[model samples]
Target chain A: MTHKKNTKAIKLVTMIMLTSVAQAQVTINQKLTASIYSDNKNGVEGDDGYKLIEERLEIRGNGQNIEAYARIDLTKFIDAPSSDYRDDERLERLLTSYHLGDWRIDIGDIHLEMGRGIALSLKPIESAGVDTALRGGQMAYQSKKIEFNIFGGEANPANLDTLSQKHVVDTPDRIIGIRGQIQANKALPTIGIFGIYLKPDDQKLNELLNAEKEDQNITTGITIQAREILNTFDIYIEGDYQKRRLIDQEETGKAIYSTIDLTIKETIILIEGIYLNGFEQRGSPHTATDTRVSYNRPPTLERIDQEVLETRDILGGRIRLERPIISEDYVGHINGMYRIQSPDSEEEITQIHGYAGLEIYLPDKLAFSGGYRDERYSGGALKGEKLKSMIHGEGDLTVGLEGYELHAQSTNELRRRPSDGDSGGEKRYARGSTLLGLERGGRMGLTLEYGYDTEKEGVRQHFFAGIAHWKFLEGQKLRLAAGTQRGGVKCIAGICREYPAFAGARFEWLGHF
Target chain B: MKYTLLAALLLSLSAPQSRADERPLAPEIKGKSTQDELINVADYKGKTTIILFWATWCAPCKKAIPEFIKIQEEIGEDKIQIIAINMDDAQTRSRVKSTIKRNKWKMPIILDTDGTIAKKINSTNSAPYTVVIDKQGKIAYSEEGYTSDNAEKWAERLKKLSTEP
Candidate 1:
């Protein structure tokens, strides 16, 4: 029944599009891409291969004061036999937006944001990890000083595969959200207030499991920015509150988080703190009692209580400094962050990280740069007085001449970790990595890299990667890259996710007219 | 000797295509509609397309939507298409639609839900991707992350794209 309804809706939209084509100043745009990769090892060593192809077309125009836009991505990917890898093939991202003076309405899969995005989308990387896109809609109105917005949507379950199906799940069937923000006048500095609300779909929850009610989560906050502070310093502060309610369980919880950031000249600093306190919600089982276990375990009924892993208080701060040492010829930078996590009854965990680097340019068309980083992790339960420390240093040198260029970089790291059962015994971890590249004018570029990691336990892994790109025509290009690496956590952001050591080669082709 | 130095300096400054220029424009899409024919950058001649590349798995993209919508409204529909492309896979389509219906976006949406368009646009497997295409179909601006400045620059590009051709 739902499929039928959707088909009808699609047909209705297509018909409308066909009819509007004649009246509007229509335009069409298209893009295509293909990528292929192969590996020699299976799940553990990277024995896998895939070929992916994608094409897209879009149309847009305005008629009678109403403006419209639409686009589509057609994609296909070859599947590997490994169960750990999943193939993606389908059409994605379909929606439209309309405008009328001060008010605008967006429908379909939509993205949203509120305030400085501290309690929301706060991350150095684009993904942010804290929030994901949603299939939803949003409406907003803006005046000279104040803007109002309200949005509601549902989470996409494509990544739900990351969760084990055996758990008592309350996958949100639908989510509705609303928010509003007011900006201060230019003369008064930029102060703002914002709020958000999220409610889950009850019907879908019931269908997925025997939950009595759908879970609902709410978050709201206010932000303030000061411009006239100290003439050169900018200050921003935000505080937020959140609540989550689940069905069939007496557990419920709420959280509060706050952030402050200050910037002065070439240096900027940020401080953030969050406290989550409440009961264990239904369908989630990780309680506060479970000690130091890998958080990536698949979901299961036995882990339902894990969701209520007790009240947690986290505090972190980051500092970044950038300055030129010799006018535009040389530069220096230092970035550092520290975090402390404390659970209601568990031991506190502390992590300290810092990186410092400098860049220099020579009079002979050559540039050089290098950096050093140190990370220390400690605290928690079973790991009594244990510490994991890592230090990394790297330098890059590039030389350029008429129509030709050469670049090279070398990186080395030393890691140490306390033995599992022995308190004072430490293990040695060392790694060295390097990259070299050569390019000629606009015709072609080639790069090669090698990495070696070793531990005191005689466990060692070496990796190599080489890539080449060739520009064949005015708007055409071809690329080939191959790489193999062993035994290292593939980290996106500071969140470390492990990918089995693997060797792979990739090929790509792109063109435009 | 002076000429040799000058030539060498020019060679040092000249590099391959700027990583910024290779960014792809987000797809533009419209559902079957009655009054306004939903259009993307491909539908206009005098305007620029500000493709806002996003994904269901992206957090900053979600946070930047309100700003994008505002920029779109401020730019006015006659000038640009603020295409918010979602890089979700096909299995996630139903949820993508639900999100669209729920958020009430006022711009035309292009589904890269399967990630096809994202790859075509040169995104590094992440979201909150953005790019601007001028009336001449040339990509004028591109970025991988979201910020208030990103929106402001996009609005600026709209003015430039509309005026160039």
Candidate 2:
């Protein structure tokens, strides 16, 4: 089934290319980039290195009344000598758009924004591995005074392979959604309404897990963004609401998320809140599905239902200010934020963070900067009350003279998270961590960085990073960077995954014709 | 030949090290500034000019302004000139100033506002950009995003620039 889908996509792309070829007025431009990374460590045996590479191609075209773009990433990886990296797969994004007078049509992987808020973002994290590329279509129309747009697509889960590995399901489950917006007077204010219908394709999964049928997951929301322009001062406000459906038998569950943002000169303030009253989906269990010896492995669907019922709510806000102390040569800024999350069953968590920094310029093309951040997080989980706090400070200085430049930075961090009553499941934070780096650039630039991190009672981490960007010929560039991160869980965004002590290196070359 | 080499060495040695003294004036634009002004490194003067590089899509820059405002307030007006350079493309130029006004920014902002200047400045294709020009027209400092400690150091640099002849 997947193969058939791939073939269909290829045919569609080819047909589009051919059609554009026939139309002499329409021009199509294409570009491709490839990158690879490898790794090796000291204590580890075997090759100790894995090579991952990706090739991306994009085609774009624009004419008097039409414009469109499409991109795809073809991925390949070499297995670690000791462990097989066999599950890697290739992914593609194809978007085609057409403009007819004031109306426009778009098909394939689509992203949409309503008002000032991002209502539909398929790829939330491009670097940290979370790629939620929605596959669907959209249509929009605009006039001199107003603009309207409607979009619908399928939501591909982040970890779909977890379910596929257990059963022979050819097609992963999907979530479908639709959104609309209206913008009046491109200068003044715009209001938008958006709604989505997420239906899980669980036909095979229901049979495999012996679960009952479920209704379509539904989400609907609205946003209001207004901007008031005065002679000397401007005021803008943006707010949004989003609701998600939680299915537990006939139990109806919903989650609402909203954000309000305001800005003044070098100052900006934002307040965001979220409340979950229904079921939310947690991550996959560590043990495989077949491991049911003493205690029954929690059913995946049931676990999802429980998560939705847990009722999680969060409220947060951030404020920032920046100003020039000495003309354009020097500037300073300060930022602070506070967040609190409360779960229906677990202890509520509260965090407060603040940071201050400054930059300076010297007469000899030398620049230096330093800053510090203090953060504290305290909360309780299913086990007992817990508290964690950290204070981190860092400074960097760079000197650029003649044809060469040198840059270095260092960070010192202290973290502490201790449990009150629970000893077995208690969490311990890093007592101290430090990072240092230096880089020099000229005809051939070189960078070297080292880091050492120690936890109160957990793991100690050591990291080394090096990179070189070399100019081979005129207009041609070659870059090589290698780094090793030992111990601790590596994370992107807030999501985390554990990898054994590993070292990695990447090399790439680029040239334009 | 000996005289020419000596002149060359002297010229290289005498090249102004400060961005303020070295930066040339905004050249005569054969055309008007109908929001299409090109922003190369040559348009600024006198004080160390800190350009706040920003884009409409950058959340961090948007959230870091309060700190920037406080720093500006503490630094006073005569010591420095803050130019908020918007990186919005030409298509979004119409909304640039209005957005600034709506955000209540008091700083004088040029429209690089169209992103042309950002591309020329070798920005990292990211928003919340901050670039510092020395008194002699040289790029003294540049960074993406805002942090408190960096803000302090930026102020310190401005102070240093003030004392330099």
Candidate 3:
């Protein structure tokens, strides 16, 4: 009887193994970038010879129910501006996830978002090497009508902020959050509720902020959304409340974000509003190096060209309209916004902004698009003496030339401010860039670019660069760039990443296997 | 002159004729369309699929998407499936549906809210990246940025993959 039972179990195990083997598949994706540079930055981090080599590789593996990702970096400097021989190699990111029926569990680095990034948002934006991801664990469940996630982790901001070429050592905060959603019937459609609790390490807080205001914050929010209403309109609204417990005091805050998009007779209209009263979520309040890292990024409700504005005290909104011009190929739009910012402070300011753009698609594989924007800020009343103003324009043109294609791009922006010395002619500052390139299929590409800025500190005002791109194999490309590049503030969404200027000859090879 | 000739010859090895035979599997994509419909990449595997990563602020993407729409209309949807994944960040995400409607985009749209899809596929966190996966769930062609003149080339690649066994 024992032998018979064992034989039956063995047969069942063999059959299951065979089935698993039949459905098994594995795939790996990788990205490797190599940079060789020799720079002449005048007085900057210039190299005498081209001996500084940096390599970064990101690899991801996927199976039927599992995924793993990692990023590794290597830097080698033999002899540079000074006599230094250093070789560094380390792993930057490691993430893994497993998928089970109706459940997914993730460990290592991860990104999370809730209700348009009001409650939580941690992601990457590539400009000059400023990308932030959380090092934590998350468990999510999804079914037909319900979804929820339980996430907790520590913050791991990017180590290097390329703009300053300085390492960022941030206080790692322990964050825990829960978000759940359900799809109710037709009228109420979707409802979501979320709560996030953040605790900053006391040691790091004391070291950075002088041992006085160790903040522990708790945030709870709710979002309600309705889509496809009458087949023409969609609306969404979110409300947030914050309870801050500081070492010396306790403070409470509230915020609201909302948007409505309406489509009627081939034209689309949108209205958005945000009211933030001291409810901003910061991952690290103050780093050792005097930088602030944020976890939640609420909508700015304005153009991104503006510098990162203070969301601690503000009430603003915008309205936009877009329609087709001659045909669907030609599109046009106009946008305007008004806001009173920094109301709690003595020097409050009111801002008004306007923007217009058009897209034109012509015959013979030709397309042209352009946009112009004007923004004004007043210290007292609407249409009063302007505290500052900005005007910007950009254009893009693409045309087919025989067997090759030509791409031309240009951008210019001018900023003016009230003259402080009385002899200043509006104190004008401007920046502009242009590029022209030609490409043929996947074989070859050649490009030339020029950029100039009037207010670039610690770097040259003019930038001239030439590049050649050659593509081959499955997913590989080699590019060579030789010239000077001026670095400045690159703002995305509501955050800005400053990059360092460069004047060098660099070769880069990018590929995946 | 000799070194230049040698370098040029070696670089030319990556031409179409010497392309690699192995195809990397495409990353998983699951999101909700602007119409609030669930869009999953796994469900559509029997035909060639073209996935376009785009955003509103990216002017080139605006140009590339329309040309792709014309291609799909001419090629017939029965043979190919094209899904445009919007990579708009949280601030600009609300404008996607309206942008599509105003532009008269005749394609299925998906939202990458936290940029999870773009990251999984190594999109460099930028816009106008295009990817093509054949019926076997393998990446057949990929391009980082788009140019207007490459429309015909993209059409040729898609049509060829659609007919492959």
Instruction: Give me the candidate number with maximum lDDT.
Output: 3
Q: Cα lDDT of all candidates, in order?
A: 0.47, 0.43, 0.69
Candidate 1 residue-wise lDDT, B120-142, digit = tens:
35334456767677765556654
In order of DockQ, best first, we have 3, 1, 2
Clashes of each: 69, 65, 3
Per-candidate TM-scores read 0.62, 0.60, 0.84
Query: DockQ (Cα-based) per candidate?
Result: 0.04, 0.03, 0.27
Best by DockQ: 3
- Of all true interface contacts, what fraction is found in model 1? 0.00
In terms of lDDT, the poorest run of 10 residues in model 1 chain A is: A298-307
lDDT of 3 by residue, A170-255 (tens): 45677889998887554557888999998765446455656576678899999888887898889988999998876546888788
Score candidate 3 by TM-score against the native: 0.84
**Residue-by-residue lDDT tens digits, candidate 2, B42-144:** 3445666677777554434554565566666677666566766665432123235534643567765655421224433422435676766665555565554
TM-score of chain B of each: 0.68, 0.65, 0.84
Better of 2 and 3 by TM-score: 3
